[model samples]
Target chain A: MSTDALTLDRLARMQTAVVLGYDPKFPAARRERFEDLGLLPDTTVQRLHTAPLGDPIAFSIRETVLCLRREDARRIFVKSVLP
Target chain B: MSAASLIAEEEKLATVALVGSPNCGKTTLFNAMTGMNQKVGNYPGVTVEEKDGLLVRGGRKARILDLPGLYGFSAMSPDEAIAREIIEGKSAFERRPDAVLFILDGSALHRSLGLLATVLQEGLPTAVALTMVDEITARGGRLDTLKLSRALGVPVFGVVGHKGTGVAEVLDAAVDAQSWPRPVVAAPLESAVARAAWSDTVLQECYREPKKENRLSRRIDEFVLHPVMGPVIFLLVMGFLFQAIFTWAGPLMDLMSGACSGFGAWIESWAPAGLPRDLVVHGVVEGVGGVLVFLPQIMILFFLINLLEAVGYMARAAFLADRLMGFVGLQGRSFVALLSCHACAVPGIMATRSIPSESDRLKTMLVAPFMVCSARLPVYTLLIAAFVPERAFWGPLGIQGLILFGLYLFGAVTAFTASWVLSKTLVKGSLLPFYMELPPYRWPTFRNVFLSMWHRAKIFVSRAGRVILPASMLLWVLLAFPRAQADPGVPAAVAQSRQLQQSFAGRIGRFVEPVFAPAGFDWRINIGVIASLAAREVVISTLAQIYGVESEDETGLVDMLKKARDPETGRPLMDFPTAMALIAFFVFALQCISTLAIMRRETETWKWPAFAFGYMGVMAWIAAVAAYQILSRLSV
Candidate 1:
């Protein structure tokens, strides 16, 4: 709800952000999968690569890189980390 | 934690399951632990591959299972569900493992450990095998396994699977799992946030983060996944793969066929000409030869595919093609299987295993046979050369080339359209989330690549061969039985023709002629169509034999077919319309029995294969009839 709130998909490439949490809009099962995949609140995420056609993008979080469809990424909220 | 429990567990081959997410080096550890002592089975209902192998030490042995990779126990796909079911003892195919070897990718701790937390709560005896330690350390990360082990109250072994380091220790520790320490307090079961907090607390002292993402991978992706260059590169890679299978494998395949025929000739040269000799040459040798010829192409295809998968290029290829393939209600992996189908549908069907979703896999497998495969080329070539004139069309391209291109295009269009229809009607499912892990690229290990190729070859020979060879024998019997009496002073070739004309297959072909009359085929073409079930190219030879020409004399047979008259009307047998009809039917029809046999092997049920045959049969009939009727009417 803050002015600085950003959905992960909207975050620019290579921009580092701290996970604020997922939007409550995601169903319970998908939300749990998000957490189980290490996207917990306060986790650091940096947008890495976008697929050629630009739908699925890869992000580096917790020393691992995961590819997320742009649709799924639009649901996760994050905040920019101060340099 | 008693010695008696350990002794009793050893009496039976205690089972240990390797559990981890995809791209976590779990298979590498499985190969390292079990060496060549591995067998692939399927989970009870789902056809996902279950890799079973053995771990031996001193005097004891135990079965080690490589369950399909899992991100969590949420069961997103059939593969994930099978992994969950087997681990929970809910699977009827496999008992609950006596112990679990949890492979934790050291480089992907946040991801692997998060999953690990949920797995530990399964209440099974567990040991952690830390993999990707080298990847971590190379990237300026460090982990103290001893400290992490103490925190979790479980034994942890650091393993570099490709190098065979610490793999034995994990198994040794897993075998005595009864004595392994249990956690004092389990991971939080209430919520995902609570579990993440639990993992963070445990990793606070032991785990360190890699300084940054892999630079080499990023540099490669710059070109490989570029908006413009990415598609260009993918096309080049696929085009090159297509050419290699058709061109490079051609000679080797010829050599295999040549050897079978040469051996058959050598046996006939010495032995008395009799039924036994003919059966040995045609029934056994030729039947086995058909199956064996696929080995080189299979080996090459798997070798390249394994290399791509091992080097992590396949995931990127899938990422690149996802949107385009999605238009057909399938994902990018289906494209790979369909591409491979151009060479042959046997390996193409087998490659569908790479597809993650069950419905997608079945859809890909069913429609792949429609792709213009190499076997159909012979029929197309003979027909087009005879019927389609060689007049120039667009630029230097001849009309013949254009028609051939049209046939290939038609095949591809039908394959995609069929899959779209299937996605709506038969194997219906929304396009699932395209979840793929683009692992950091590494050199593909030769041992792993060779082992994978070997496993596929074995499966083809054992599973497909069991059905195809016996079926080939039956086809030969139908074409060879109830021999016509040899008339004195008659040429052997003509006498052979008489025998074939009245043989069981010939009778059936005539019986079915009325059914095919609408499609412009008579009994001779019907016989060729039926004989094609052995392999599509057999149609050429069957026609050659029907005209009493040597089966090897293709040109002679072509001339005969072009001039011959229909028995009743004395009209030319094959015309432009019939050629159109034949090509139309071959494009849509599933003619090869071997394809069905392999489909049976992959799906593990007769239902889907039967449905594929029946539906394709109807499609072929309608297309053939329509093409013939329209062309004949327009010319009139």
Candidate 2:
């Protein structure tokens, strides 16, 4: 409910964001995978592009571009950082 | 099952593993390390395959295993699970690897290095084969391999896996498993948070990424991933892929078919002319050769698909198809598989290995056969040529062409529908997160491509020779026996017909005729259906035989088919409804034995194949009856 509680899915294309931790309601197993993938707090992720059909957004996280579905991406909260 | 023969008895060769995240060039490294000296087999109790190769240096041999790609230590998929258990020495299925040669992709260092935390935690003697360092340098990135080695407490050697650069040093160090040093400090296992922090610390010390991300992939993606242009390009690429399979593989397939038949005839010339010769020539050789002819198309398909995969286009293709495939309850990769089925389902089914999810792969496997393959071409051509009128519907599209296109469309729609129904009924909801790594574009090395093509062709040929040959022989027996009791003076064609009508296969055909009666199939058509199991084209020859026409004389056969009548009804043997029904059935039926054989091998079980056969048989019957009824009613 805080003003800074923006999720990864809302981040603009090519805009970098600082990880603000995963949503508490996110399933534990999947959330754990996000952590393993270097989504730790303060890690910077940049939204690169959306797939042709507008999902599985490609994001540069920890120097690798991962194509993630919007459903999972939306569950990870982040604060958009200006270029 | 292993490279055991390369070592002496009672002397166990040291084992080394090439481990990395997917698309990190681990397989490239495997080939670089052990070229033309590898074996591939399924890991016990899993459909995932195991590949290990022999490495010998100065009289010392080490077996190198190429573990499946993984992202992190916490196993998310079956591939990761298999790799995880083997590394931790917990696998009852495989001996613990003596050392781990971590394949580090310099271009994706942060995550790739972070994955190293898990590998380091294993505490197995470790060395890193730093790959794609040139990619980093080309992009103006700097990497000090010596500093990286010192930071990680393991030897690090930069290597271009495709070019076989620096492979000798890595293999030299890895070959002596006991001498390789373990990590100075085992990584924290409590959480990825701790590991990520530690890995970042290591990166901070020695890694400098290209300030600018690789721009080539970005520039290409701008057009390839454009909403309109991207899809158009995807279609053009897919259209080209299918066209290659259908048109290009034709001459090669014809050549193979010619060789098989010529060899069969040559052998027949040497052997005595009798029932045995007939069985050997017509039953075993022709039956087996029919399936062998598919090798050209299958191998060509395998090569192109692997090329797309290795060059990273397949990931882009997968991304483009995600939403569409998701609509049909499949991963984006399933689109390629289903499309490949349009050429042949065997390779289509084989291509499902790229689908990360197990159930999605199985569902895709189940759905693949419904797509019209080249095998069905002969039957469709025969039916259309024999019954369907040849009037032009439009430019470049005749009634015959429209009918063929309609059959293709029907197959495609049915494939998607079958997948949807399966999603709801059998596989249920796909709960796995639909995530994939859209890797940066890279040119495929000819070494990797050729090895891939050769490996697949070998597997297909050997497996086909083993499984399909015997099954075809059984079908031959059904069409070849019971001694028709015709005098030797009779004509060959009449003798052949009588012989076929009394053969066990014919008896079964007659027995099964009533079951298909409602679908407008007679005993002769039933015989064609039963014989088509060898391959869909076999129906043409089978039908040609029973109709008392020469096997190769298709024109004569079509004429006879059109003029022939049912003795009971005094009507044409194949009316419009009957032809329509047969075409409908062929579109839906799982008639090819090779498809089922590969399904059995890929799934590692007969249960799924049996299920496929049962469901497709039922659907084919229903579709046939519906087609027959609709057309007959309209005509009347």
Candidate 3:
């Protein structure tokens, strides 16, 4: 598969940087709050687990389990060990 | 693990404590279980409060305690301390729950599961209530509910608490399920290496991520959190909320005022002539009516706040304000509590319970009185009507409402500065770091919205009955007594009323007039100030009583206020500048008894409230004096 087409599960295990900022899908309010809570781009986060329905994805950053809408997750770039 | 030893001793009707991170729909589930059966109050020593309720789930009725939301249960913060104590049955929180409803957002299972995993090792009989199922589904994620349930060795139920979807089913299953056969409890991690080793394995078995485009939230957060535009958006949103409140509540305010005045007039005809009629019309009706008029304003504010909180915008506001608020040595959460003081300070001070830090809580309670409360409305209205020209600024901004808004802004600024000064001078401390969980945005339930509004209205009316009525009656006695003796040289009407000028109130104000001379306040204004200490709304009623008006609700208050003549110049009493001075005085003054009472109770110290009143009183007088001097000089 192309690098851009990498599976989310693979992306979860890898750590990379995403160029863009807040995702477009969820409300602006949530993203702003996440940023205030120090969950911003280029910050290293371990992608933990997604719920069965998978809207709010959990990531472990600075030992805090920060939950973000999936749309927010895609905007976030994670470097991959496999890549 | 002896889990069986711990469980076989569990009592039926055992308490179930629902604990989780904030914004996890925990409150919604609590409400679903308990209905109108929750009590809100402060916890011991610390202000971050507790909410308690009883739930009848399954075949047995168990006490359900809703603990303050914690990011984790590691016993670090006061909130976490309470959660841990309850779980360990070490705290006086009515003993440990028989089981725990370890509720988490189904949308963020892994992060939530991190906490859940900790709870599982606690060896407590626990079940998971997976909420926000629909929101998760919409995001193209799915949960293996049965598989996860089996792996965790506990029952898990899917619930949408707001919609009442699958709530009863989940609740029934949760309360009915007994302790499972005792299983091995994980050993406590010995070191950093051990913890790292354990958490990795826990994540592997139960967690998954969805494969999709994370495009939506990213785009929105970009514009909203933009350094330049974010604060602007916040202000515009707040401005719109205020404008909507004023426009929406205007008609209701007018209707209520009219009905009150009509009722007062009708009662006047039935009351005996002289003191009885004056007391009924001027003291009771006008005093009470003044407070009632602000009902719509209070209601509108409450509704808007509840809506904001429900829709989850409140958390976002806190996020935006966090940095600015830290400068004043307060958590961003304290802003909402202090803002609510504009409606009434009592509840505002009570709301300080939500601020986890004791120093932040005390400081918030102390400065809350400085916020111009709804009680100050009557004073502002009377003065504005008497003197302010109704001309609009730039043809759109109401000069009157703008003035009112300016006073509100002044109060807010003063409150922040005062807190900063207090933190530096007396309550010395570095600002505490804040951690808050921002919940997902959701539609507000109409039930919660209406219920909150109703609660506020009830508090308003009850206060009117308990405090306002007695205070107005006392003012009535002071105004009405000491019947004039006949003087041969004077006409009967003149002779009968001369005693009022000689009576205690008259003598008192005259004695104090020199003190307020610099502030441009005459004896009448001084007397009005004295009467307002009982309740600020009583000032207008007292003024109407002193003016010898029998019916003061509508015609009496307005006419007498217009007729008031300045003792210094013998001109119309309330000139534009003097009216401006009066508004400024009330804007800064700590006049409300209710506010002081709440402050004293919250702080558990009479010294704080007394000191607050002294400082604000001095500030008010100086500000008013300076304003008057400037206006008088410019006029000359």
Candidate 4:
């Protein structure tokens, strides 16, 4: 596969992943970017689980569990997955 | 070079901007690089904090501008916009940076490199500082910095910011690369997908990660984040926090109180019997002493909160709180602002800058002052200790401790209610989605925690000296002057009371007494309330002066208040019902002048602060009246 095609596939998969939360490190800007994506559905809710640090969060997107950092979530193009 | 020439050269140092994603340990790196040679100010026309430090490498000196953390150059929040403008050389006050220290988190390299791609496109002489390499390696991940640097066409240094590892090399590289050509990516990633792909490719080449999940962190998080148990654990943690603030700090508070009293006694004995004696004893020592006694509580509170934040539990707490905050029409992000208000409303209001929505920011600021800040600790401690029984409840919890917790909870509930009301009526906005990074839990360093506590203590004490000292002196003058003609037959206590009634503060208190009458406040309480408008803790010191006791002798004030009578009814002045009413009143009152001033500055208008003060004042009065009336009837 071409690099662009692979990139597009990876991006598509990421876009399907539910956004758990933004990394608190760069809170405001990352949050703004996440909101701009407009990926979260009204029915979507935060799923919390135990991690060494505290509760690592996940978002319920359909039935898929895509555990990723908030920064990663920001890179996923929401427009591709929307509607 | 001559000394004059060297000084001149240092004055005109080149600029280096340290740019990074938030939570990438950029600040720790900046602190390690700059050490004590740093100055903090605000960006031009913006309240966002600007930190600059002098980095002297060999004979070269550069001013390092620690720009606010940003994800990309796209201006979103004020922090990002300000940073973007500075980096782009569009800032009116700052010139373009001569070099850029681009920091990336080693554990999250793929995501971080996305930002690096943007930074590289800016064409500045950039160097990469990869942070958290230790954590990455501990988690069975490997990063080849050399290869990554070669690929990016920039120098990459592996550094642990907190441990000061590999920092000097990074600084040297940053300073020496001044003449280096502006960085150009071999292939620019134009679209978002391309950028993600580019970052992923780089990560694939340079990094490796262990396949297994982190068991320890996961096990701990399971219990901490349980839906039903999470809130229960949070409440228990918070309850213990407040209780410890009272329990652990009692001895230190007594010691501080004793020292103040001893110092005042020395001053009284040394000075001749006159206005100078009264002024030195009552004004400076007594006034500042009352505040100093509460320093231990304030320090302990800050220390605990800082530890919680450093341990990364605060973010989880915010995530848990997001749902409830949503019900109040507020973003979970406001939780940070409210938490900051626990220390001081000035910083709390300032922290609202992190909330992206203008309406959310304003609403958060409006209700933030209602949080029981450290300033209220002195008053609450005094009132609770004086009025409430000290008997233990259910083995360990003292009634005083529980009452203290109740006061804090009361303030929080009132703040949330106020936010909901204001959001519905004045500042209507949609609740922003909660997105908070739960940071890795780490043991909080003693150095960091101590430094934080010291900083807070210094601010509190300085405020006492600067604002409270002068206010106390003014109160002393108002209370001490217009000495009544003494009838040689009158007793000293009676004579003092009569003299106080004739004084300026006493006269003003009488004038305002009728307004507070329904709230069960007398002329003496009126004096304390009026004086406390400058700062909440002033009420404690003002009451000491009104009761003719040294402010440090809090026990003496309590004893005096116990015996004190209403001039008309001859009943005890500070009854249980009245004390409860006073506590309720203070829970809602916007008493801090500094909070008001900061609100004006943050909102850039007097309209919000004025509205906050008027509404809070009215709410406090009504609450106080209801508590007094209801409790008095119940007691009867």
Candidate 5:
């Protein structure tokens, strides 16, 4: 298969992906779901909050900077292409 | 693929392997699918735990293999190697799985994609189970399952394993999936940079999300993960936990103690006076009850720890302690294993499988038993209540409670010190960086908590039956045999003491008294100590039997012990210094046969367990002697 045909697979194969942020109202079960999924939120990524408004969260996963809304970031599947 | 071809594939693929990264809700999903139909064993030639369960759906049955969580196909540790071998059809135990259920975390797609890619590359008939979908949508994010499925050229089903949401649909799709095309050999990404570039491209195309931050989690982490306040909070939490273990379990422990005594009295009343009656009433009932009384404490400890784990504060505690652990040349991950030792060292040692480094795992295993496990609770409770006064230190903290807390603290300190020494001498290694994900905090489900507590209680009770029962019977034989002639003038307690001294255990205790003399132990204490080697709590039962007290009457035994005098000096046998020395000894002693046997099993060798026994034995003797000498001098 061409690399394009394997684009999704290749992304899945990346060693690291940044977690941008998560929703404040994120259910404990859902957070536990992530833990169950082996993505330990605290240990896996560094969370950085912006001053005054920590609305958009930033996390570095292997040099990838992901900026996502708190609500939408709970289940982020990012694979950064940066070397 | 045509339906006929799909049918052929499904026929050959009778087994489904649930593969995912560690903590990916894979086990939970497996439980949902298999329910109670699972068999757990060790893989051939390795101690890695293997779980196999039956997956029954639509009148069709397939075997499901729950492999240990793996990061990739490249196996680094024994656990990962087992996972890799089974996935590659190289396992001696079973053939390659027919289909792969690739579990992916819906919330953290980027991290999981790498493993998913590897699974797809293997060319198995694979289906994606998008777990944590509820968490995703709950966070105001939606996953385009169909779009993502079409994009990846495979079936993707969203599932919430615990809630049974969309799980049946996922299982149906997985069972019906046709053979997937194997990836043609392509030039592998030669550098880390190339791999990252590839992952970036694939994620950008398939996954869609709203730009947002998790503000609530951040606000909580600010305090929870704070440096100074974090440790303070952790200490306060632990202090409360230990206090609760004592105070909360008091009523239950008392009830168990009372019930055992009543049962023993009832048995004694009906049974004829002979070896059989003595064995049934004193040996079996007393031994089992002595251990059973501590069951409430064990259950409560596990229940509280599990609640904390469910709440996700354990990870943060580990994070804060990482630096201190590093200073001791151990990983922060060892914190959980050590914490778990409070309930039982066996599980705590088993939990070391998560420590990737070999040296670190071994060190953690060695020190785990040093933590004051529930097995020691009975001994501590007995000793502290007898020796320490009931007066309050500051407000509600009783002196006895403070001493109990001190013993726990002493265990933890000694364990850390031992770890440092071992890291420096025996198992030298650099500290590995801590990489752990702190799950979002939530309320613990009552079902989950209750089940966990129930499982621990079952294990403790079963062990009492399996290991303690036989050992108790053996001890009874040793103490009851070589029957002494009954003299009318001899008091019953004195005759029983004479009978015990002439028995095999008594002989052994006498033979060892010279060695134990420095620690203030006489022949009777020596016999209790020897019997305790079978299990620590047996010391209490053995002492009761030696003193001729009814097996159920603990207070009577305490009164006897208080009046016990050394024939040579006429001083009380259990003086304040002697009690302190005995407490010190139990604190450091490796007296649990079960713990040693488990260590042997986990390490796959007798050498380490033997070493643990030898070192701890020596340490216990020295600590006991020093405690006795120092305290005696102060009393004089």
Candidate 6:
């Protein structure tokens, strides 16, 4: 499975994952914060929105935005949120 | 009428807090808004203090909160934790600030905006206080404040905080918005996940492409931050500042000394003979003047340093020296406190709070006493004048100032080595990563510069009165008492001192003499050093008293220091070997009483302070012995 193929949907259910990498192709203003947000390896994040510019993929963890780039989204591992 | 009444009833008092990194002109804005109508009080539950001021805008008073300078609201430091707990409204401290005024340094908005974005997401009635807007434009960069203001969906005010420009309008907008309920956080997320929408929207709206590079800043940084050139610049700058201490103070010091001694002599004649005359002329005037002579040098050194700090170059200097400091097992931030030691060490120890780590602060506090403070200026100046020839040793270098600078350098190096050894043995921790934002340079305002210098000079003089005065008087009493019968055929004056030399203090000096002999310190120097435990300036006065000279004798300090005779060998006491040894000893000795007081305050346990003093005492002895032996062998 291509890392880019792992969508936020794929990420939300992951029991454990690290932000192994990131892609700047997305037009995120705070790429560094997104990278250095100190997210634990293999945490769950539920995707909420995809902005009009096809970047700034917003998600929720403890009700905080765990925004990530498309490539960053791929690096994270997850189990499906679906039962 | 119904809309107005409903809106009025719904409004609640709220807070707009300003938080940013230090030196970002936040205080200036706070001052302009609050003036003297501010209060500094600790947070209700935490020891960390908070400053709150009331600002009137749109005919309503809004509480302006100035939190501690936090680099980010997240992270584990107490400062950060406090900010986090407050924002979350989970802490025992007052509820979450009603709103936050995210002040960003316009010149460095990229990083500043990162913090701004975090604050904006709190779902509070927020605004952006864009500071240093003029500096950005002046430096060939332009900002569309309106663009930023619109994008963030909140009021954004372009303010030059220091000059009070555009701040009034900013306050008016803020105060007006305070009563209005927070606008629906319109920037969209999935309706189900609206909670995270605010964070994403704020980050997107408030920031733009940073100017590719700060060209002039980069050029200067290259040389100033170069490892090789950096330390050289630091040394040269410190050398210049220390040199100015003596060279600049010469005329003023002379004027002060002359006025004091002349007044002393004049008073002696006018006063009727009795206890009154002795107490007034000898105890009060002479002792006070002795301490006052060093004030000029202390003020001058402090003035230069305060200016450097205000102009923001000191932080850069610290950044440059971080590597070298790490080599010696200290963080670069400790350099600010150590640099302050040149003026006095008490406040320097207090300044170590910026170090953030307990062990690092402790290490800084332990070594700070070794930094030759202004109290030692009199002793160094008197000795150098006595021993070193006035002729320039290195063409342009003033021999006296060079020696003074050397003494300061010896303390600094020894402090570094001491901290390094402690780290290896007791303070076992790997060096933490040091991160500091370099504040953009600014021309320091004259009022601020002078006020800071005045503050430091006031501290030095007050310490003299509270500590030095009684300490000198006690020694004076010890030497003056126990009048022995005059030896037959000897003048009563000469015989009195001879008899007094066997007094308790004198005997104690003799008893301690053998311990100091390896360092070539004579009995008088031994007494001077012991008396100096109260404060170093007393060493000069104590020596004067021992030499049977009045404290106001301007010439005796120089002459006696030169003429001091070694008891065993009957040679000049402060010759090359002894001079070097004395300098080295003062360099390593933690002799200042205030240092002891501060150490006790900083470390609740007296045991650690006792250990600190014991460690420095042993180090001082070893250093003095080594210096004396090395110089003596060279002479032979």
The TM-score values for the models, in the order shown, are 0.95, 0.96, 0.73, 0.76, 0.76, 0.66
Q: What tens-digit string does per-residue lDDT give for candidate 3 at B1-636?
A: 122112324544556788776767787888788666555444644444566655565456555677777644432556667787877778874567677888976755545665665566677777888888777666666666666666667777788877989788756755554563223446664332343345446545654444542334434544554456656776776776656555666688789889989998898868777766877787888768756765776677777777878876665566666556767877666877787677667667766655667778888887888788767877888777766667788668978778878878888898999999988888765222334444556777777777656656665556334555565567656655665565788654444345556666667878988888877877777777876876787777666555545554765676777786654578765566666777778877888765665565556567888888898898889988988878877852
lDDT for model 3 comes to: 0.65
Model 3 chain A TM-score equals 0.55
Docking class of 1: medium
> How much does candidate 2 score in TM-score?
0.96
lDDT of 1 by residue, B194-292 (tens): 767777788898978668667788789878988789989999999988888888889999999999999999989998988999999999999999899
lDDT tens digits, residues A1-83, model 6?
A: 45554444354422323333334353332333232242323434455433223333445442133334454455444444453
> After best superposition, candidate 4 residue B44: deviation in angstroms?
6.2
Against the reference, the lDDT scores of all candidates come to 0.83, 0.84, 0.65, 0.69, 0.68, 0.64
**Number of clashing residue pairs in every model?**
0, 0, 28, 10, 35, 5
Candidates sorted by DockQ, best first: 2, 1, 4, 3, 5, 6
lDDT of 2 by residue, B1-636 (tens): 565434522477788888998888888888876789887767765888888888777777788889999888663678788889899999877778889999888877777877888788788899898889888888888888888888989889999877778878877776687688978675465677777678778878787777777789889988898878888999999999999998999899889989989989898889998878888788778877966887888889988999999888999898888888888888789999999888889888988988889889999999899888888987898889988888888887899989888888988888888888889888986445667777888988878888888887777777656778888888888888777896889889878888889999999999998899999999998998999998888787787788777648778777877887765678777888998899889888899889888888888888999999999999899999999989989963
Docking class of 2: medium
Indicate whether candidate 1 or candidate 5 has the larger TM-score. Answer: 1
Query: Model 6, range B1-636, lDDT digits (tens) per residue?
Result: 122122333655456677675566777777677665565534543335566667776578666777776555533455556766776677675557777777777765544554555555567777778888777766566667777777676677889866778988877765664653343444433321232334335445544434443455546645764547756887787677656764677788788979988898999988897567867776778678766766786577667767877776676665555655767778666886787677677667755655655677788888888888877877777777876778887878987888788887878887888899988888765222233445556777655566545645554566334555665566656655555554678655456446457666677788999899999987877877877876787777776666655446658667877776645578775787787788778777888666665555455456766888899889889989998999889943
lDDT, candidate 5, B291-379, per-residue tens: 68657776777677777777666655555555567656676567767876786776677556556666888898998888998779888
Best-fitting candidate, scored by DockQ:
2
**Cα-based lDDT at residue B215, candidate 5:** 49
What tier of docking accuracy does candidate 6 attain?
incorrect
Fraction of real interface contacts that model 4 preserves: 0.05
CA-based DockQ, model 2? 0.64
At residue B62, candidate 4 shows an lDDT of 70
CAPRI classification of candidate 3: incorrect
